[model samples]
Target: MPWDKDASQCAQFDRVFLVLGNHEFYGISREDGLKAANALEVEPQLLGKLSVLNQSRVDINRRVTIIGCTLWSYIPKEYQLWVRMKVADLSRINDWTVENHNTEHLQDVQWLQQEIHNISLEEDRRDLIIVTHHAPSATKTVDPKHKSNPWGSAFCSDLLESQVKSWRGSKIIHHWIFGHTHWNTKFRQHGMIISSNQLGYDSRGSRAPRFFNYWFPQSGQDFVITKTAKV
Candidate 1:
């Protein structure tokens, strides 16, 4: 188990950035979730070497910049259920404690907004990408079956509608990738290509050899990523 801390396992990828998903915050209650999250906090130096991030940005290979964060989901109503539960099994099994929620604390969202603002001030945009475990825009979070319903949308719609557009300066977000709603969706919105991905998790462990395949998502799909042009 101690070897799990090793970052070399991901040597296959040139860049690796990890973040805490709502799953990390799923527990009996908000207090428990908070404790759970705290327990997940790896040593900062160790996390840096592993390329894990939270409300942070990084320049990879001097070519592209990626920002990562996780936002709380909208309150539970039957409509928001489909969008926030993540997956049917997870919905049924995991207690939904994070929904009554935290985007209002101004901690996560504010940091992301400031990051964008800072990036805008710099002359070099160089392919900026946004990656969060939760959806930010309504257009990206809506349920296809109930597109007209507000409950089927994201928690922080205003942040997407105004806050991002009115930042210090203008910059185009070419791609936005998220996880919470474990669906493989791709569409172009505003001027960016937005998409979401998630690896469905019914259970996590290796007690047996019958969980799921790595290349294929048996629980659903591991998160999806939007591939953009080279900067």
Candidate 2:
């Protein structure tokens, strides 16, 4: 699917990284789904320009390193059963049980923590930018209307409270960009810039506002990242 004309457009860049999301596993076995997703990195049509970041890191330059993963959320215990039965992921992704989901989430969290710890020990540390498919924090990510809804737990994790809070004064990590809630937002939290810029659903009635056009101009120019912070 990554070789599709629209997706292959990413080849225009010297390097492109993709973080597989939940939907990427839909309609396939977990193992097969991962194989398919990884296939994108080697897609010949893209001239080997794409890198699928699965609990991995890539140094973009001497100053920046991006760590990326699906980073699946930790569904609240009360909502776990509801999510298992009601969410389309369980019904569609073959061999993917709620237990599997929980296991992957834990693994991803551990991998991220270890990666950060390794970086912290390095004599020359690069500015870390985490890119996750799932929202790292639930705060201001869930729709205000669904803030009290148990289902909101499916969209984001408590990484902000559980992990990021511990790095409040750390200077190694600078930004965390994520998506899943489909809410476009940018805010500073725990000494880092957290942002989500998503196209979301195409329908006019979609709850997530459609601001992709503004963020990504139709003029074919690359969007600029003007938001900066002193690390």
The TM-scores of all predictions, comma-separated, are 0.63, 0.83
Clashes of 1: 8
Cα lDDT of model 2 overall?
Answer: 0.72
- Across 1-231, the per-residue lDDT of candidate 2 in tens digits comes to 333555656756787778888877777787887787776667678787787889988887778788899988777678987787656777888887777877888898888888877776662467898889989888886556556766666678888877766742345778888877756678888768888766555334434234533322221222234443334
Q: Which stretches of candidate 2 lie over 4 Å from their true place?
A: 1-5, 123-125, 167-170, 205-231
Which has the greatest lDDT? 2
Q: Give lDDT tens digits, candidate 1, residues 64-101.
A: 68887765444445555555443332353245433435
Error of 1 at 29 (Å): 8.2
Question: CA shift at 217, candidate 1, in angstroms?
Answer: 12
Error of 2 at 50 (Å): 0.6
Candidate 1's displacement at residue 15, Å, is 2.7
